[model samples]
Target chain A: MAEIAIILLNMASYVLVLVLVALGLVVVFGMMRVINMAHGELFMLGAYTVVWLQAAGAPFWLAVAAAPVVVGAVGLVIEAALIRHIYRRPLDTILATWGLSIALKQAVVLIWGPASHSVAAPMAAAIGVGDVTYPVYRLLLMAVAVAIIAAVFWIFLRTDFGLVARAVIARPDTAAALGIDTRRIYRASFVIGTALAGLAGALVAPLISVDPQMGLGYLIPAFISIMVGGAGPLAGVLVGGGLVGGTNNLATVWLSPVVAQIVVFLLAIVIIRLRPQGLLGGRDGA
Target chain B: MAPRWLAGVVFMALAAFPLLAADYWTGQLTRYLIFGLFAMSLSLVWGRAGILCFGQAMFFGIGGYVMAACTMGLVGGALTSSYLGLAAAVLAAAGFAALLGYFLFLGRGLSGAYLAIVTLAIAYILEQTLKSAYTLGADNGLSGVPPIDLGLFGASVELWQETPRYYLVLAIVAAVYAALDRLLASPFGVVLTAMHGDPRRLAFFGYHVLSLRLIVFVIGAAVAGLAGALFVAVDEFASPTLIGFGLSTEVLIWVALGGKEMLLAAFLGAIAVRLMESTFAELLGDFWILALGLVFMVSVVLLPRGLIATPLGRLTSGRHRDGT
Candidate 1:
């Protein structure tokens, strides 16, 4: 019974990580209709920012806080320089972002060298729960992920900026005609997505080995989750993350991690085959 | 579209290349010729059929594995013939593509980025699977695959020298290019163009869009498989990286930079970019990636027609329509 509880906890934490990794992609791809292939690289940049800041004698908390800001600023520049030009062309956006992803990855390698780095977990204590003890940091990460998701939902559903952003997403031409400054909305939404990805990366940096290629490991799963979830905002990501992450975790118990990944990927392919709009997506899922 | 005489001229130049270059350069050009064949396969599906396959190396890798298995007598003793190996490689790749295409294009169909992403995922999965499959040599890959042995009813000849191997690969590439050119100029090709221009309209006209897509996908896979088979013979080895994401994207960069709309341009693109890499990689170190990225971005954004294709298209009276 205790083993079951521990497994469930582990699964929940894994699911939360998956959700966090995919959150920014959901916005950029789902909301903006822009396939940001460099989304993973953005996450990497954020983690690197935290590492660099903490390495420079800054407090760990301060480094974590500054990660999103640094990544967001970088995203803003990318949006202005490259993404803006290819917004109308989805295929071109994929290619362009792919190029950006490669450049960013190589740039990271150039700056930091090829060696992997590890960050100390800020809260390095475990709490007893019945027969099993769990890391406090893992639980804290779960809470942070939940909070971030809620914040995003509230912003998109309740805030004025969210409203305008959705308006632009739904009908860019009409929104532009209505004097909504659609371009600014695009820029802001892109930045928000980038910042969220950065935050997720910062939060999880201590959990995994940090390196230039770390982002790529997360990229495939995040893409699968978002794709399975459909391109919708909150509901899509939630359902997609739950299904993919849940299945992946459960499968890990029965199968090897590699086999589990293959199963999850095959499952995703099956889902997309059956429901082209995704599980929770409407007609405009594309 | 590129003037029929140009093909002959290029083939003649390639045929005479060994006479001008040393043995080392000849061997290097053999590998480039194989890559050029791979690029042509991509151009067929991406350029002519309007399906931008992001994971083309998957087919190429599949072909290489099949060829390696057959020639090394890993599959069965009867399949050890190089001729049989090449045939099986093409068949295996096309079969895989056909199966994948059935799932992908049978329903509402995955198009554009969705299709690209799914293909990329599949390629990644295959690469990972191969990496762990110890029977297939895992990360070390399969080595010592014998060179091409043409034995027709007991008369056999092995292409062991660089010049012979280079000429053999060149002839194969030229044949594939010619066949593709003929196919692209046919009535079937006209329908393919129409399908790309507007699939829904073509479907409304009673064309089986899914079947057409599958056919083209299989053909492209077959060609890619042939390239992979030839490549194994040239390199005498096959690794998981041959079928992975990095090589897949590298091919994409080559094709895009050369010009996807024209087979010749894309083929040249692979050769040219590879030549440049050989020259610049030593000088620039890791910065070559940055340069590649910048070139990719610039080509996609500013010159969608590609560096060679854009100028060449204008010169050739713009016969081929621009495609992404």
Candidate 2:
């Protein structure tokens, strides 16, 4: 019973991290139609920021708060420069982002070597729950991921900016003709997308070792989630993340992690074939 | 006048390459040949068929592993020699490609994004599968592959060192290039080009657009497999790198750098990028990816048509060309 509870807790943590990762992709790829292959690397950068801050003798709480801001700022710069130029062509966006991913990964390696960096979780949050001792940092990560998703949901559902953003996605040319500043919305959305990815990375850093290649493992599943959950819908993102994360975790527990990955990807392929639009997606959503 | 002589000259240059170059140069050139064949196969889908495949490595790797198994598998009465191994590898690659391509291409439905994602998934799955199936050597991969042997004439050509492998690679590359060039210049090639432009338009003209794409996609995978077979013969090993996403994307960069439309150009691109990597990576080290990124950005911005296409455009326009 205890082992099962621990496994379930671990699975919940996996699903939580995946949801955060997929949420960012859903925002960027769903709205902008860019695949953002480098999104994983952005997550890596966020994790590294936490690693760097922790190394510099900063308080863990302070580092956690600051890491997202720093990473989000980098996301803003990426949007302002290269991504802005290639908004109309989504495939080109994918290629460009892929290039960015490679460059950023190499940059991370150059700065922090190829080895994985171990980060200790916050001293206060290192608590036990019942017989199953769950890392408080992981629970914190779950909280943060859930909070961000809720915030995004709130912003999209209630805010004027999200309305305009949805309007642009619905009919870009019409929105442009109506003088909605589509480019600004694109830039803003991209920054938000990148920031979300960074936040997920920072939260995940203490739980996993921070390495240059860390982001890549999460990339395929995040993509699968967005595609399976439907592109932009919040519910789809959660469902997609949960399905992939839960299945992958359970599969890994039963089989090997390698076999689990293969199975998940195979499932994604099948899902894609059956529902070209995605499982939870409405008509017109990618 | 220049086109015919250019083709002939290129062929002649390739023909004379084995004799002039030393053993080391021959092997390096052979690797180039194999990569060229692989790149050209990608061109069939990416260039002619307008499918931006981010996962050519899947088919390329699969073909490589199949060849590895054929040569490495010491089952009863099975062929262990490189020649038969290479042949078996090629057939196996093509067969798997036919199956994979049919399913993937069917689901693709002319959506480039969907195709890219699907291919990526296949590559991801296969990569993980390769890691798990340790009998094929997994992460360490299969090594100690013997050189190919000809028939029972007791006069077999083997790649003992760089020279034999180099020349062998050169011969295969030249032959593959010739075949590809001919195929691309055929009426079928023209239809493929048209399909790339507008699939729906071609479908209206009674073309089995999906079928045609599938055919080329399979052919491309087969050619990639052939390259993989040759790769093992030349290098004497097969690692997961041959089928990795990095390698796949690198091939795309090669095609884009050289000009995807032309068969020869893609090979040139491969040589250029690899040569750059060999020369500059020591000095640049980790920043090498930055250079690639810069090159891609510049190419995307300035030479979107590719080096070959840009030069051809200049030549056909009868305009004075700027230094590329």
Candidate 3:
């Protein structure tokens, strides 16, 4: 029972990480219909922001707080400079964002070199969970994930911003005709999505190796989760993250981590095969 | 279409290049020729069929593995022949594409971004799988795969020298270009153009849309596999990067920057980008990526037809325009 409980906790943590990484992507891809290949680069930029701030004598928590702002600003700049121009051409957007991804990665490599950096977890202590003890930092990560999800849900579903954003997504011309600035909505949504990805990166920095290429690892799983979950933000993240993350964690218990990844990919393929619109049955951008 | 006379002239220039260039340059050109072949494969599917495959390296990597396995005698000692290795590489890549396409295109079908994302995922999966597969040398990759050994009857002629190897590669590339050009001008090619233009309309005309897509995908994979096999032969090494996202995106850039609509233009784009990398990557260092990113952005936004293809299209009186 103790082992099972620990496994469940571990699975939850994995699901949270997947959800956090995917939340930003879900917003940008689902709402704007822009396949931002550089989405991972935004995450990488957030991790770098945390690292750079920490190196400059800020506390870990403070650095984490600054990450979303720094990365969000960068995201806005990218949206204005590049993403704004190619919104109509989806395929061209893929190439443009891919170029952005490569450029961001290379810039990081240029600035910090190719070596990996490690960030210390602020809460190093362990907390008792029934019979087993878990790291406080891991527990904090889960709490953060839940808080962010709830926050996003509230903002998108309950707030005026979310209502306008959804309207723009559903019918841009109609939204524009109704006096909503669709362009502003696109820019805002893109920033919010990138900021979420940034926060996720900052939160997870202590647990994984931080490097330019590390974003690719998170990006792939996040993509799998989003695809499996479909385009709907809240339900998609929950179902997709739960399924991909839970299955991967379970596979890790029974098989190798590599095998677990393969299992998740196989599961994604099957999910895509069965539910072409994704498991949650949302409409595709096409 | 480029003037036939211009193509002949260009071929003549390439055929005479070995005579004037240094042996080292000739060797480098050999490698570039293989990349050109890879770019042509991408052009065939992406330009002609409108299927933007972002994970072309998967097929290339499959071919490399098959070539390595066969030449190393890891897969049936009798299959150690270079000819058999090349054949196996093409077949393995095509087979993988057929299976993958069947799953991807059979039902409601995936197009645009969904297809790109799935293909990219599959390529990443293949890279991870190869990295973990100990029999294939894991991350270190397989090395020392023998070069092309053309055995006529009992006697074998190994292409070990620089000039001979260059000539051999050139001959194969020319043959492939000629054959592909002919194939593109056939009735099947017209169907491919129509399919890309309007799949629903083609389906209405009783054409099996899925089968056309699968066939083109398989053909493209086969060409990429052939290129990969040749690459391993020239380099005498095969690594996980051969089948990963990095090379896949690089090839995509090559085809896109060269103008995917024209096979020759795409082929030249690969060579030009590669040559530019060798020169500028050393001088500019990491800033080279920034330049490349700028170029890619500009190409996508301003010159959707490609840098080379735009002028070529105008020069050829828009003959190369495929209604895209």
Candidate 4:
């Protein structure tokens, strides 16, 4: 019973990470219909920023706080320079973003020299949970992810930006007629999405190895999460992330890590076949 | 007439490339040809049929493994080299395509984006499966398999080396390209073009949307398998990377860069990217990925129809407009 409880706790934290990663994908792919393949790389950038800042002797909390802003600015520049033109064509964006991912990966390799960064666990957050001995920082990480998800949901539901963004998604020309700056919304949303990915990376950097190709590792599952949840739906991302995360964690416990990963993918396929739009995905976007 | 001669000359040059180029370049070209074939298969489904299959590598890897397994004949040695191995690889790929397509083509007609997501999942799942032991070789992949002997000749052509394998790949590429061109020029190709323009209208005109998708999907898979077989034959190695999403997307980029509508475009794009990669490796070292990204962004926005397609359209239409 104790082992089961510990497993469940670990699974919950993993789901939290999935939710953080999936949130940006939902906003970018769901509303924009633009599958930003570089989204994972942006996450890597965030993690790298934290790592670099920490290396420079900055406090861990300050590094975590500053990472997203730095990453988001980079994302804004990418959108301004390249992503802006491809808005009219979604497939083009996918390909372009994919290229961006490759480029970003290479850039990371150049900057960091291809080795995984040793991001020390925050000393303030370490804790004991009987036999398991959980890290307090991890718990804090979960809280942050939850807070961000809530904040995103609130913004989407209650904010003017969300309403205008939805209007653009529904019909960009119509939104233009209604005096909404569709282009600005697109830029802002993309930046935010990238930032969310970065934030996930910053929080999870301690747990996972921060390497150049680390983005590619996350890219597949994050995509699976997006598809299983329904591309753009927040609730769908939640359910999808939970399903993939929970199952993956449990499966790893029972089977080898390789088998566990395979099973997770298999489960995702089954879910997609059953509900193509994802569990919470509506019929709005393709 | 001059253009036709130029094309012929180019083909001949490519045919005799092993003799002309260094051993390393010959081997590189051989790799490019396999990837080119992979890209061409994607073009059939994505460009011509408008079915954006992000997991084409799934078939490529599947065919490779089937070829490897059969060649080794660990479980079923009798099936190897009995003309059945090649058939089995192609059939297995086609079968897998049909099964996956059945599920994907459910509810509403799948858009390119949705298809990409679904296919991405498929590719990921397959890669993971191959990474696990007992079933696939897991990470390291199955190796030490002997060359495939096609019966009439008792001696197996060792494709592990460079020169002979280059000739073999070029021949297969030519055959594949010719078959693809013929298929595209047929009535079936016309229907696919129509389907791409308007699927609802095509369905109303009595065309079975699902069936057409399945046909193209299966055909594409079969071709991918052929590429896989050739890949294993040449490299004498297989890795889960064959079925990776990155590889599939890379193939898609090649199709986009070359010319989706033109079969030759796939080969051209593959060659261009490979050459650029080698250049980047030599010069830029670590910054090549950045250059590739910039290239992809520029190519998509400026040449939406691809380099060959846009230029060919311009040249052909330019002459006609001037004449009129």
RMSD values, in order shown: 1.6, 2.6, 1.8, 3.0
Worst 10 residues of 2 chain A by lDDT: A123-132
Better of 2 and 3 by DockQ: 3
In terms of docking quality, how is candidate 3 classified? medium
How many steric overlaps does candidate 2 have?
Answer: 2
Tens digits of per-residue lDDT, candidate 1, A68-162, equal 99999999999999999988887888888999999999999999988888988998899996788889998998998899889988998899988
- Write candidate 4's Cα lDDT for B169-275 as tens digits: 78878788778777887899899999988999999999998899889989999999988877776677778888877688788888888877666666678787888
Best by DockQ: 1
Docking class of 4: medium
Residue ranges of candidate 4 with Cα displaced over 4 Å: A124-132, B1-9, B107-109, B134-136, B148-164, B316-324
Q: Model 1 misses residue B124 by how many Å?
A: 1.2
- The order by descending TM-score is 1, 3, 2, 4
TM-score of predicted structure 3: 0.97
Q: Can you write out model 2's per-residue Cα lDDT over A138-189, one digit (the tens) per residue?
A: 7777787778889998887789998999898888999999999999998888
User: What's the lDDT for residue A52 in model 3?
Assistant: 98
DockQ ranking from best to worst? 1, 3, 4, 2
Error of 3 at A144 (Å): 1.5
DockQ of 2: 0.54
TM-score of 1: 0.97
Candidate lDDT values, in order: 0.88, 0.78, 0.88, 0.80
Task: Give lDDT: candidate 2, residue B32.
Answer: 76
Worst 10 residues of 4 chain B by lDDT: B315-324
lDDT tens digits, residue span A123-240, model 4: 6465665656667877888788889999998988789888888888778899899888888998899888988998989999988899987887777788788778877556888888
DockQ of each: 0.75, 0.54, 0.68, 0.66
lDDT of 3 by residue, A1-286 (tens): 8889889999999899788878899899888889888989899998999889999999999999999999999999999999898888878889988988888998999899899999999988998867889899999889988998889988899999989988887889999999999999999999999999899889989999999998888888888788888875467878888898899998899999988898788879788767767877656523
